[model samples]
Target: MKWSEFKIHTTNEAIEPVSNILHEAGASGVVIEDRNDLDKDWSTMYGTIYELDPENYPEEGVYIKAYLPVNSFLGETVEEIKQAINNLETFDIDIGHNKVTISEINEEEWATAWKKYYKPVKISDKITITPTWEDYQPVSSDEIIIELDPGMAFGTGTHPTTVLSLQALERYIQTGDSVMDVGSGSGVLSIGAILLGAADVQAFDLDEVAVKSTTINVKLNKVQDRVTTRQNDLLKDIDVQADVIVSNILAEIIVKTTQEAYQLIKPGGYFITSGIINAKKELVKQDLEKQGFNIVETNQMEDWISIIAQKPE
Candidate 1:
C-alpha cells in the first residue's frame, strides 16, 4: 500500500492546533520535528535516552508530519487541512511559515518507523508516559505509568501542554474526586486523572476521531470503568459538576467556556487550562478571573503556559 507523508512547516506556537487539524483530517500518525528539541537539556532521572539527528530537523520553524493513506479523497483532505490551519489565525495564533508539502512512501516504511520518536519519559513527579511497545518498569514503588499508542491518537501525552496538565492534576486531584477533561485528546488527561486517584472522569472532545481515540486509550489504561468518553463541544449544554475541570486546548476556545466551566465546577473546585501560548496567557487569565475564578497557579514549560484557577468556596 502507498501512503502520503503530509508535512507542514509552522511555528512552535502553532504545533498543537496544526497537529490537531491533521488528526481531524484522518492522518494515521503525526510526527513533530522541532529544531529547538536538539538544544533541549534532557534529564537522565528517568534513564530515558535521546538519540536525535540534526538532519531530520528544519533550520527555522517546526515540521509537523502525518501519514495519510493514498486514496481518491486525499487531495480534498489535504486542502481542508491547509484551510483549517489557515483559519487558526482568526484566533490570533501565528501560523509561521505555513508552507506545506507532500511525498509518497510505502506503508511498510512508516507503519513502525514513527514509533522510534516515542519512548518512556517521566513527564511529571509521579507520571511517566511510555509507548505500548516499550518494555518499561517502575523504578520507584510510587511511580505511575501510562501506556499510550500514539498511532491511534493525536499525541503521545508528552507535549508541554499535556505535561503541565498532568502536573496540575497531580497537585490538585483528590483521591475520590471527579474530573471533567475537555478537549480530551487521546484521553490522556482523563486517564492520568484516574491513575492519580480520581474516582471517575468525564472525557469530552469535539472531534469524533478524538472521541474514539479517547475511548480506546481509556480501555488500554484499564480505566474504562472510571472514565467515560463523550462527543461534545467544550462544555456545551453540560450540567454535571466535577471536583476539577481540565482543558488542554487553545486559549481562545478556553475563554469561550469560562462561564460554563465556572457553573459546572463545584465551589472550591479548580479549572485547569493549558495549550496556551505565552502571548495569550493574559487572555485566559483575565477571562477566568472575570468568571469569578481565583488564579491559584501559573506554570510554563517552554513557550506553553498552564493556568490553574479555583472557584471560591
Candidate 2:
C-alpha cells in the first residue's frame, strides 16, 4: 500500500483548525513540527530520550503533516482540505504562509512514523494524556492518566484548545454532575468528565467518524457505563439538560450555538468553550453574554482562548 503525506506550512495559530480540516476530510492523526519545541527546557530526568533534528523544523511557522492512502480521489480530498482551511480566514484566523506540499511514503513506514510526534503530555494539573503506544507512569499518586489513540480522528487530547477545556472541566466539574460534550471529537473531553467524577456524560458530534471514535475511546477508558455517544448537530433540537456543557469547536460555531448551550444548561450550570482564535475572542465573549451567560473565567494559550461562563439561577 502507498500513502501521500500532505504537508501544510502555517502559523501555530492555525494548527488546530487546519488539523481539524484534515481530520474532517478523513485523514487520521497528524504530525506537527513547531520550532518552538526546540527551545523548551525538558527535564532530563525522564528515562526516555528524544532526538530532534533542527533542520526538519521551520524557522517561523509550523508544518503539519497528515497521511492519506493513495487513491483516485486523493486530489479531490486535498482540494477540499485546502478550501476548508481557506474558510478559516472568514473567522479572522491567521493562516500564515499557507503553503502545501505532498510526498509519497510506504504504508509500512507511515504506520509507525507518526508515533514519534506524540508523547505523554501533562495538559492540566491532574490530567496527563499518554498515547496508547507510549509507556508513562504518574509521578504522583493523585495523577490521572488518559490512554488515547487518536486513530483516524482529530483531537489527540493534547492541543491547547483541548488542554484549556480539560483545565476548565477539572475546575468546574462536580461529583455526580451531568456533562454534555458538544462536538465530542475523539471522546477525550467526555472521558475526562467521567474521570473527574461526573456521574453521566452525553457526547454528541455531527461527524459519524467522530461519533464512532468517541464511543471507542469511552470504552477504552472503561467508562462505557457512564458515557453515551451519539451523532447530532450542534445543540440542535436536543432536550437533554446537563450540569455542565462544553464545546471545543470553532469560534463561529461556538457563537452560533451559544443560545442553545445556555438554554440546555441547567440554571447555575457552566458552559465551557474553546477552539477560539485570540482575534475572535471578543466576538464569542459578546455572544455568550448576549445569550444570558455570565462570564466566569477566561484562559489563553499561544493564540487560542477558552471562555467559561455560568447560567444564572
Candidate 3:
C-alpha cells in the first residue's frame, strides 16, 4: 500500500496542538523533529542511546510529520488538518510558518523507518517509556516500564508534556490512590498512574479514537483490569471524586476544567496539569487558584510547563 507523508513546519509551542490535529485527522503515528533536540543533553544513565541525524531535522522550527494512506478523501483530510491547526492561533498558540508539504512513500518503508526515532528512555526516576517492539530490561528493581506502540496512539509517551505529567504523578500519587486522567491520550498517563501504585484509574477522552487508543494501550501494558477508558467531554457531567486528577492538554482546555476538577477531587487531593506552554503557565496557575486550589509545585521541561495544585483538606 502507498502512504502520503504529511509534514507540517511549525513552532515548538505548536507541537502539542498541531500533533493533536494530525491525530484527529486519522494519522496514527506522528513524528516530531525539533532542531533543539540536537543540542539537548540527553541522559545516558540507563544506556538509552539517541542516534539522531542532523539532516532529518529542521533548521529553526520543528517538523511534525505523519503518515496517511492514499485515498479518495486524502485531500479533504489534509485541508481539515490545516484548518484545525490555524484555529489553534485563536487560543494564542503560535503556528509559526505553518508550511505544509506532502510526499509519497511505500508502506514497508514507513512501517519500520519511524521506529528509529523511538527507543527506551527514562523520563523520570521511576518511569521509563519504551516502545513495544524494543527489548528493555529494568536497570533497577524499582524501575517502572511502560510499553507503548506509537502507531496505535496520539503520542509515544516521551513528549516533554507527558514526561512532566508522569513525573508529577510519580511524585504525588500515593499507593492505592484513585486517579482520574483527563485527556488520556494513548492511555500513557493512565497506565503510568497505575504503575505508580494507583489502585484504579478512570481514563476519559473526548475523542473516540483516543478512547480506543487508550483502551488498547492499557491492555498492552497489562493494566486493563485497573484502567477504565471512557469517551466523554472533559469532566462534564461527571462526578467521581478521586485522590488525584491529572490532565495533559492545552492550557485553554485545562482552564475550562478547573472548576470541575476542583469539585471532583477529594479533600486534600492533587490536580496536575500539563501541555501548557511557558507563556500560558501563569494563566493555568491563576485559574487553579481561582478555583480554590493551593499551588504546590510548578515544573518546566523545555518550553512546556506542568503545574501541581492541592485542595485544602
lDDT for each residue of candidate 3 in 1-313, tens digit (9 for 90 to 100): 8999999999988987787788888886888899988888776443444798999998898999999999999999999998999998898889999999999999997787678889998888888899888999998999999999888587788778998999999999999999999999899999999999999999999988789999988999999999999999999999779999999999999999999999999999999999999989899999999999999999998889999999999
* Over 4 Å off, model 3: 44-49
- For candidate 1, write residues 6-116 as lDDT tens digits: 999999889888888888888888998888878777864434545999999999879999999999999999889989999999978899999999999998887976888
List the candidate numbers ranked by lDDT, top first: 1, 3, 2
Q: Report the CA-based lDDT of candidate 1 relative to the real structure.
A: 0.91
Q: Report each candidate's C-alpha RMSD, comma-separated, in the order given.
A: 1.3, 2.4, 1.3
TM-score of each prediction: 0.97, 0.92, 0.97
State each model's CA lDDT, in order: 0.91, 0.87, 0.91
How many collisions between residues are there in candidate 3?
Answer: 0
- Which ranges of candidate 2 are over 4 A from the true structure? 41-51
